[model samples]
Target: MALARQLFNRRMMWMLLGCLVVFGGIFGFKFFGRYMMNQFMDNMSLPPATVTTAPVEQQRWQTRLSAVGSMRAINGVNVTTQAQGEVKAIYFESGQFVDKGALLAELSALPETAQIEVLEAERRLAERDFKRISALYKKGVATLRELDQAQATQDQVLANLAVQRATISERSITAPFSGQLGIRQVDLGQNVAPGDPVVSLQQLHPIYVDFSLSEQDFSRVKEGQGVELTAAAIPGQNFSGRITAIDPSIDPANRTFLLQATLQNPERKLRPGMFADVAVKVEKFRSVLVVPRTAISFAPYGNAVFIVRPAKSALAESTNNKAVAPSAQAPQWIAVKRFVKTGEERGDLIEIIEGVREGEQVATSGLLKLRNEGGVIINNTSPLPENLNPTPDNS
Candidate 1:
């Protein structure tokens, strides 16, 4: 019985030992799998990102003040009639160019023309009687009063004729100035009253552009300052002119002052009331650092840019150590994010006031995928546009 009991104990002990080995193997396998995964992840590296880059450039930039404006003719008016009468004849066609004093229309004047003939006949009769009275007065056969009466009648008749001629002249309508005419408002035989619109006349050549500027810019502007203009109606065309006039008083509501610029419209393409974009060259040219606008990464906190440089060089600079020795492999490039201070923008380029030096390469595309100190492969085959004055591409 003692031997059997001892054998049972040993069997139980062996079973327990087998159970411990199986559980230990399972736990160790799990821990080994987890350790292998962490090692693989730590050694792995992301693929280099493809990006486009542009070099920082220093150039002379003109300082300009911009504003919206409207085009106007130097002389524009709504032509109207001065006399009340029926239009007997319409001499001018719609949109015809005319000179000063050129007849535009004529009113019906038959009554006034007929009255002149009667006055002339009456004057002839008065002159004959005055001659007979004068002959009698010289022979002492007529009273002085008789001679005076004859002379008075002749003078009265002459005055009546002069009044009739003046009345006939008012029936004619003529151009007040040399300009192009708009659509005709009066038709033939249409009765028109005084102050009624006849047509519109505008002197389009050497047109004026009316714009306003802030009162703060008042001192920077003066008569004869150069201005450049562009209109959406006529795209891709630039018009140059000079400031011709400036309002002495500032607008109380907006605190802006009015300015008028004169530009020659030889093609007559610029019409009155056209909306225009005006840029006044306010200051002399000065040197400034510029970069492609796409290079900037705008954020609510601040603006930033990714500067591309040799990976070894960047790492060494960050560590404040000397550059690593050159390797046999090709040089690796990396993107380093940098905060920047920006100024006014022109076209697709923006002025960089701080953070980057001239000639340093900056990433212009693929900014979203880039990380600080990340590897980059430059592919400028499809470079972004960097025009100083960009325009729409309808094609």
Candidate 2:
């Protein structure tokens, strides 16, 4: 009888465990479904997000090519001495403007000058002797050989004097052309060797600016085309110039076309080795739909934009009042994603080729909170940037 009671007690414990497991499973399944349905309904009843919008308008677009370049002097060189000698005197000061053929410095050539004087005295004496010999020979008192010897001595003395003068000229260094001089490198009374640099001369007027463009634009770029340049050193000042030269052969390594432009720098504000920014007008478009560059969103798939979807006639105008406090004066708009065919970007603005029209409005600032057909309200109190050619402010 005790054995039978033990089997019955085990069966009762097993039945109670099975009942608890089944009841918990049923309750948990119902709770999960109810919670998930609540979340779905909440997302469906979400209010429209506020976003800033701008109208796409037609504007005249002038295509331009931009490049970074460097400034160079029209004529620049380092002045050097031809002959090695001790500096005797410096005729010009450092950083002085000199003319062509003006003496810059003189080397000690005293010995050569003294030798010139001695040759000149000998030449005079030989001339007098030759005259006497010729007179004597004409009267048959002197031999032909004696007269010939006298003439040769006079010619030899004159040639020696000329050679001495040329030696002195080599010792004296002069400016080759008129230009502003740099600081002198050699000191007074210092011995300098041949080919040693003395000063640097640079012609500041009409400087040249060299820049490069892609080989694809080789046909559009030509000599005499106008270009504008600006330098960071001199702010707010723009220099205008024309294309002086274009390299016929493209750079095979970089596939670029090297170009040079000439600009008049009368004040000498533009200097050699300065960094310059260059712009050349390529072509113009009569009418184009443009928007702020910030309005477009770039993605791996393609470039896209959020266009304001029109109101539906079937939906009530007061529908926005259901989710959030809505104003009757404010127009309701829905965001619709569109892939656009874009053209060149002009500074802060960009050109839209297709997928949008002139009268359509686009979301500019609030792109983070948007979906394919998300509802939104248009608020343009803070407008997007409209600068077509924006530049950084250095100051």
Candidate 3:
């Protein structure tokens, strides 16, 4: 009976072990199959990305140098007082346009007026005595010395009266040039001393923009070159100007030269003290090689572009250079590492000064996924990824 019971326990243990193995296999197969199917479905449903491109063309490339600069007025004058006195009245309002010699401010002139009257009375008394003396001299009744004293006294009094009139004129402030007035710092009855600024005036019809160029650039720049400017206040609006002045001497410490441009402020919209972005057209290259900035893949070694050529030729070039493949699905591309010397960049277009020839298409789009000798599909769309509209005429 003991033998039979032991055998029965062993049989039950075997049955339990078989059931556990069957259940484990079923769960493992279901989980593994589901994970693999999900990955396969994801790969199948992905869509190809759309791309844009630009055909290589020959054109005259305008070399432009861009820099940050500030706007100034053609003639900005700070109106100040020459004599110290109490402000009697304000003649002009802030932001009011005035002509040359227009009265802008007036100081106290009551004391000056009284002094002029006193000098006039003294001159009258002196003149009466001088006339009487002159009559006596003509008749030989008065000596020459007495007549001379009276004449000198009368002349002195006349000079004093003239001096008083000139002093009164100085108390009134007048515009030195035709311009719009800035803020008035003082009101009536405010005391101002000599050299105190009364109001700021600026002639803005033809504004001036001041900028600095490096000594190397200054050597290449010339007067009458076309310049462009844009202010922060006026978005999307450009102002055109010409290089009016260039400094003869280069600053030795900074190796920069000062320059000025004259811009037309028609409508008087531009004001002084505004920050401006300036661009000067230095050179106009004719029928030059140009490329989109997106085409140039910059690396520590050099800058390169992908040329869409026949698959066999691209493979031969890549095999010859031994380049790594890119891990993305862009058009089949071949990396052509050319040492190109670049010129000025304007908008999204850059002038290829050297190492590129006309009529050769460079990759403007799909640059990030390009590999050496990879097959490339040409998509000729546009060269500029940004705005391609011609710049507005701000002349």
Best by lDDT: 1
Query: Model 2: clashing residue pairs?
Result: none
Model 2 residue runs over 4 Å out of place are 1-53, 62-70, 88-104, 126-159, 180-184, 188-190, 211-221, 230-238, 247-258, 267-270, 273-279, 282-287, 294-342, 353-355, 363-385, 388-395
lDDT of each: 0.90, 0.84, 0.78
Cα shift from native, residue 292, model 2 (Å):
2.9
Collision pairs in model 3:
53-381, 53-382, 332-374, 332-375, 332-376, 333-374, 334-373
Model 1: runs farther than 4 Å from truth?
Answer: 1-51, 126-163, 293-306, 313-331, 335-342, 365-376, 380-395
Q: How many Å off is the CA of 292 in candidate 1?
A: 3.5
lDDT agreement of model 1 with the native = 0.90
Candidate 2 lDDT tens digits, 163-280: 8888899898888888889999999899999899989988888899999999999988888988988888986577899999998999999999899999999998999999999998
- Give me the candidate number with maximum TM-score: 1
Q: Weakest 10 consecutive residues, lDDT, candidate 2?
A: 313-322
Comparing candidate 1 with candidate 2, which one achieves the higher lDDT?
1
For residues 197-316, what per-residue lDDT tens digits would candidate 1 score against the true structure? 888999999999999999999999999999999899998678899999999999999999999999999889999999999999977788899999999999999999999999867776
User: Could you give candidate 3's per-residue lDDT for residues 1-395 as a string of tens digits?
Assistant: 99999999999999999999999999999999999997666443222222345545567656677777888888898899987799988889999999999998899988889988899889989999999999999999999999999989999998888888889988999999999999998788988998999999999989988898887787678999999988878876778999999889989998888999999987898888899989898776566666787877778876776666544455665536543334455345444545677765656676777777777667677767654454555655543553322354579
The residue pairs that clash in candidate 1, if any, are none
For candidate 2, what is the lDDT?
0.84
C-alpha TM-scores of all predictions:
0.72, 0.67, 0.71
